[model samples]
Target chain A: MNKIFETPLYAYSRSPDQESEVAVRHKIVIVGAGPIGLAAAIDLAQNDIPVVVLDDNDKVSSGSRAICFAKRPLEILDRLGCGDAMVDKGVEWDLGKVFFKEREIYQFNFLAETGSKRPAFINLQQYYFEEYLVARVRELQAEGKAIEIRGGNKVSAIGVHDDHVVLEIDTSEGPYNIETDWLIACDGANSTTRQMMGMDFGGRVFEDHFLVADVIMEADFPTERWFWFDPPFNRGQSALLHKQPDNVWRIDFQLGWDIDREEELKPENIDKHLRAMLGAEVEYELEWSSIYTFQCRRMEQFHKGRVIFAGDAAHQVSPFGARGANSGIQDTDNLIWKLKLVLEGSAPESLLDSYDYERIHGADENIVNSTRSTDFITPNSEMSRVLRDAVLDLAEEHDFARPLVNSGRLSVPCTYDDSPLNTADGLDGPEISRPGSTCPDAPFGDGFLLNELGDKFVLLTIDADAPELVEEDGIAVTRLEISAKDDTSGAIRRRYLGNEPTAVYLIRPDQHVAARRPNYNENLMRAAIRRATGKE
Target chain B: MSDLILTTNIDHADDFYAALLGAHEGLSKADSDALNARLVLILANHIGDNDILSKAIDAAKSSG
Candidate 1:
């Protein structure tokens, strides 16, 4: 083993090592050891770039918030070598039931029509998920990757001079100075870095407060998502129940804005709510519980000088659609690739700007959608509740109301309509044909699926009719043909192009459509690749 | 002020990446803007010196 790997710190000094403190700048500095920051470190360090992670947190929080993982983030976890562990530990759920006044209103099976190795979503506590990520970071460090993790180190100040970012870091011992080429602040919604930079965080903090509890149950219950609306005892209250591993279930109660924060968090109060939801017959012990308020807000900018933000640092969405952490991870996914390209000299620094462009749109979209969901689920006004209940009643039986009953909005991926990398037919296409939307799965050659075509840029053309475009200089492309009637191909055609596209379509590595043409031409095709990759 | 697009409309490869930078300028998310600039400078430092990006930072200060 290398001397550096054997000893991460240059020396174990009681006082700050003065000689070793000669502005030892790293290629990148990451703030916060959360999923987004850690993912950024893993990707950058793997590519041989020097990285240092800073966090004020001495230990991972035991808070069991954010209990769901969507498909896109699973792909990212797969890339970082933690996907298998996540899948093993997480409970896959494709079926969810919505209840209105103690009756099932409508049910939807996520696995009903699609076939893929990745389910629609999985349920797992965020803290355990963090442990899995930390393990991967440790493995990478053992291999002499230039990734450094420093916990309990508060970033006291941030100053971006034209040449580098100078950070004032407070350690257990004393305050010290660390210089970095660039900084990423994944420090979360209450980002001290953002505040230091003097950026505006504009949004509304809703009047409603929710009590989230992770409980260990003694009674047997079906493994399904049980969401209740307007229960009898807690008038104008709602509850969310999902089974976690080890006979534990995460439950949430909509305890309107008026309750005392401390009293509501008490174990007795939490147990009372759980028993009320589960009925007194079902005995349970409390594992963990916290009272949190939901907010619909976003930062004015994700980037300022050498410091960038991701996850909660960038935006905070109410947790209705499970967009908070998932969206942040997507930001990491979007930024990491561009950062890699810039570090490797394959792309310019400007490429990093798209991270802000792409992800902010995602956060904005999430806030709007999730806020709407919060309103529908927990209507503030009596008239609105009456209207909602009436709608739920209609949703139970009327076939016409079924689709309306299922807003089908939560599962819908946020569209990046404004991405500079977006093509003319980009995110604007119908959900199926949307270029900037998640690439739909379809059968390609000899039974290999379209999603199998993920992991690299793919240019698919329906026409075996058009001659293959010569592979461009720095882009990946593929072309194939299948009859419209082919089942797998039919599904793909239905999902993506609405109908099978006549010409050519290019998909980005993240599975969003980059470009499409009515007919395939080498120059036009190459142009699309250049545009998406920012060569033009 | 509006949604940030991840894909570019430009057909040329060079222009597509250029659009990525250009689009970031129009981003509305507060965190997205600050983080985007930070990533650009950080990535730029990995490639070259702190000259251009540093100048941009200085310019931002004057404008603010």
Candidate 2:
């Protein structure tokens, strides 16, 4: 078994705030040192914003909870300076095979195209993911970035004000008080911060339970996702198997609604199921086992006054699509830049409302996809089962039925369509890179397009004339010029330019497209900058 | 105008109905339901157009 979780990477330490005469105030306080909170702290600190993260626990997550890291989050982590470590340590695979009744129905390759830097998905233990984020936080701290993570500091109470929020944190020594201009809740699904605020997290709750067992084993199974429906071993239920790093395999078994949880989670019972699935000859040791029932829910609004909610604190989705932490990372990616702008007074506080609007959009997309996948996997009604089984049966021989099979749709980046921050698109560019879509990465110069854009509002002009710098309403927009002739693979042209010879795109600080045109206009570009920053 | 032809498009309608019924001749209720589900999926794929398929579903519901 891996010993990383047994050690405290962020062991509790006494801070000056605990011994202060009065409550100390900070620019921003993030509650929870999980993936989202740490990523938010790193992003804000990289932007020169002082942020503090508080959590009750001192170690990384105990089990390999969330195992799949999608490409978009990997890109976001790259911006946060920890992507290389994750990808290097993670098991990368794009192929997924679906099985029904001991026969392979169909297979899919998630990354069918080329020129992107990251793979479609990587399977790394969630503990390793958190450890990398914490390591990045340490590096930023060493570089004099204003980021502090206080372990064993739990927020027991919260008070919301019009201007700032006050938190009562309980430490090992005693309870202390602190104030923050902004409060970000990166706490998990059962968020104490959210409970203190009395916010509503409403959505559908799936009635089925899933057992996840992380086993340390030496198996020759290829590094691909394998999902089975109605297999002979686990007769009626579904099963999922994925390869994580360090010779660890994560297996999930769908146990029906009315089973004895404690009895089923027994080591003997789990061993029996594993022996049946892996055949009697296989050898393995159980590293961690958990039985989880999930709900696809979110708060009505992510931003409530001075207090903002993010990650599992704001929304919870079924684990089928791997949306939980992936979308949480995206939540912070959509939030920190806006919070930074609000703090710097470059944009109005209402600009943060767009965060509520956009991440809710992302949360809804995740909820819908996950709910559908859950219904397909664990059909509630007899007719639903009949149709689901029909799809599976036909999928064995028919190509059209393959798409109907939904083991899990997998996580993909959300496009903020109809976003209030997006300016009207003027160019007939590729629909995938239109206004309100995440910028597709392409080979640019020596690196990728996303690397070139970095964390800034960029005017990406391809064979188009645009000034190097454009400042509108105190927001600086830099230019990244690329000629179509220089793109050797033509990926840039296909992804960004479409059929247009020259195109200009206004990309946001979060690397989402804000506006685009075939030719750059000074007045229009300035208005776009204003609209993108919520000055409109 | 809806793309789904609600009018009498099948020339041998009676024969087609006979064949549809003939497909589920000797199956139990569960097997018949599964067969019907598969038939719906197959014919839906053959139709391919979501709009027409949706209209056909509406028509089937209203007729039922």
Q: What is the DockQ of each candidate?
A: 0.01, 0.05
Residue-by-residue lDDT tens digits, candidate 2, A234-315: 9899999999999999999988899899999999999998998999998999999999998999999998899999999999
Candidate 2 wrongly placed segments (more than 4 Å): B1-64
Candidate 1 has a DockQ of 0.01
Q: What docking tier does model 1 reach?
A: incorrect
What TM-score describes the B chain of model 1?
0.33
> What lDDT is obtained when candidate 2 is compared to the true structure?
0.89
Residue A192 error, candidate 2, Å: 1.0
Clashing pairs in 2: none
- Per-residue alpha-carbon lDDT of model 1 for B1-64, expressed as tens digits? 2222222222443233223334443444565457556876776676464565565356434421
Per-residue lDDT of model 1, residues A1-536, tens digit only? 32211222212233232246475676789999877888788777766778888887645546667778887787667767787788899988877888877677777666634644466788887776777787788888899887777876789998888757988887767778878878999998898988888888899787898888888876676777877777665667887888876677988888998899999888878777876777888767777888888898888777766678889988998888788778887887777767766666666677667777888888877876776667667665544454456556655654333443323245355667757777687322246556576665544555435445545567666543555444665454665544445645366556644543554678766667777665666777777777777676
